[model samples]
Target: MTTERQFQHDSQGPLRRIVSSVFSIFETRLELIGIELSEEKERLIGVLFLGLAAMMLTMMALITLTVLIAIAFWGTYRWQSLAAITAVYVLVAIVCALRARAGLSNAPNVFESTLAEFKKDRDTFN
Candidate 1:
């Protein structure tokens, strides 16, 4: 009976250790994910603010330039000037849309480090 109890205890010790180690790895991975998420959130917010400011400034400049052109050519080329401005604006919009689409398509994968860590762990286990 004593030997049997000893054997059970010895088996449980390693099993417990393995469970504990697994939990530790999980905790570490979760913490890493949290950190990456927080960083991404901060970066996104910063980009949002900067992008808003840039858009506002660009809109103001475009409006001012259009008004100036219309006023300067009001005597003879008023309609032509406006039409040309409209065409330019349309071209700019299409180009910007295409560029933005391309940029998004080429963006790096999010949580790259976390994925890499997971792959490393899997490879090590295998």
Candidate 2:
């Protein structure tokens, strides 16, 4: 009996075609998703820059207004006025600090959980 070679001549074999089609679809979807994410990142970065600029401008205006008010009121009080303002500023800062502490305590701690989940997924897939 002569050995015969039977080549796989059908390029559209069911499983291979199906796998190729699925892979192409997945590739297309991933590409589209990447493009969307890149666009979103660009938009978010632009917004961050604009917000930073606005915050800086507002802070500058506020500082100028505060200086003007301070100068206007400077003649009414003695040197003790500066000390009193400093004390008030300190008190306000303490209250803000306390508020920030409370906020931090209430906020979700996601870093460790996120890292763990990321590692788990990486190991499971790869």
lDDT, residue 63, model 2: 65
Cα error of candidate 1 at position 7, Å: 1.0
TM-score (all chains, Cα) for each model: 0.97, 0.54
Judging by TM-score against the true structure, name the best candidate.
1
Error of 2 at 57 (Å): 0.4
TM-score of 1: 0.97
lDDT of 2 by residue, 10-126 (tens): 544776987886677557656656666677679769988997998799779756765766786788864565566667768977997999799779965434444454566558558
Candidate 2 structure lDDT: 0.67
Off by over 4 Å in 1: none
lDDT, candidate 2, at 36 = 62
Clashes per candidate (backbone, < 3 Å):
0, 0
lDDT of 1 by residue, 1-126 (tens): 999999999999999998898888879999999999999999999999999999999999999999999999999999999999999999999999999999999999878998998898889779
In order, what lDDT does every prediction score?
0.95, 0.67
